[model samples]
Target: MRPVIPYLVSAGLFGLGVFGLLRRRNAVLLLMAVELMLNAVNLLLVTADTTVRAALPHSGQVFALFVIVLAAAEVGVGLAIVLRLFRLRADIDVDAIALTGPDATVALAATSPSLTSPTCGTPSATPGAAQ
Candidate 1:
């Protein structure tokens, strides 16, 4: 049970996670890659708890539990976003998505005319501006 072995395993897992994140384009796959990275972190934390002499016993395990909780929450939100994107656009290709492109700007303006030129009919809400 060499300490270096666990460290190397954790590093390898993290590397694979990073590779998946970079190579995958589907939103669901991206979330899975992030979960892989989080699991690697949990493995590292548990290994540290076993190997290191800490003042608080099992602190690393506690941190790992927290990470697990955080990962669950992250997966929930990420899946919700992916599902919403799929419903709206009928696809979840992350590479094809653009939140701030010209089309997005135009769509926003089309949806909310008040956000466009204030002269469209809605009074500008800016304080001390020329009416």
Candidate 2:
């Protein structure tokens, strides 16, 4: 078996993961791309374990397992945040979500006066609030 084959495959997987990460704007798709990248790393680790005669047997596999655990945790937290954002904004497009900059500051100031500095921008009172 040619050891180079696994390396090539791992490199391809990593490249695809990077492309997905860069191109996708949906929050869910972004998480999936991160998972893909983690999986690529796992693949590389396992392949290297097979290729190299390390003193500690299966250390790479152990590390791969750790990566899987980390990925699972990340997905859980990420999905929770995405769900909350969806509930709040009714949209999941990452490009539409801006946490900083002028637009965000203005929007935030309009929604809640306490969230923005008094000098930052004029806060608009919501409907039903006492004038």
Candidate 3:
């Protein structure tokens, strides 16, 4: 196979990740997008390590391992935050998040009716309304 194939696939995955990160409003989806981007980088790194004649043959693989570790840590922290937000507000829509001032929790509650209101999960106040 051509060396460029893996690079192109990696680029596509990175582009898809960026699109997902920008387009998604759910915190979990955003985290998944970040993981997608990290995997793309990992794929690129391993491909380079195997195909290129580098001074250190396993340098890219080592870096990819680091990225994997970082990605795992990131997922752990991100999920914790998401779970906390879900518990506090009963929702995980990122667009509804507005952490400002001393009354940060109240701010989100006041700004987004879908967050604290009775009709939160109903079609009357959809996640799109917060945006």
Candidate 4:
């Protein structure tokens, strides 16, 4: 049996998942998209395993197993982070987490003298001043 059709379907599903992940702002939707991508990969791996059973043995299946384990761990950690962000900010928008903004950069530069000065050992006379 030709495996091209199944591979194409899996590719289409993966593409859809990528689209959803990029376009959706909700954390749950993003997680669902990630799960879709993982399933698409698993489908392709299984299809490859079936087609190359004689030559490749069970390598593809083993790889699929590893991917499933990794996906589970990723979902767990990703959901935890999402929950924490939602609790702190009351929103799940990925764009809002700007840790390196202009204000933050300026504040860090002002506070850290070693970061702005060329002389690493010499301390400035003014407290918190760059050397």
Return the lDDT, model 2, position 119. Answer: 61
Better of 1 and 3 by lDDT: 3
lDDT of 3 by residue, 1-131 (tens): 57799999999999999999999999999999999999999999989888874677798899999999999999999999999989777899998777775467556556556565333444344466755
The C-alpha TM-scores of every prediction are 0.78, 0.80, 0.78, 0.74
lDDT of 2 by residue, 1-131 (tens): 57788888888888998999999989999999899889989989988887774677898899999999999999999999999888766778898776877787665455554664546345445679887
Candidate lDDT scores, in order, read 0.84, 0.83, 0.86, 0.83
Ten residues in a row with the worst lDDT in model 4? 115-124
Better of 1 and 4 by TM-score: 1
Per-candidate count of clashing residue pairs (backbone under 3 Å): 0, 0, 0, 0
- Name the runs in model 1 displaced over 4 angstroms: 105-131
Q: Compose the digit string of candidate 4's lDDT tens values, residues 1-131.
A: 79999999999999999999999988878999999999999999999999989998988899999999999998999999999877666788876555675655444444555555334534435678765
What is the Cα-based lDDT of residue 127 in candidate 4? 70
Could you say which candidate leads in lDDT?
3
Identify the runs in model 3 with alpha carbons over 4 angstroms from their true place: 102-105, 108-131
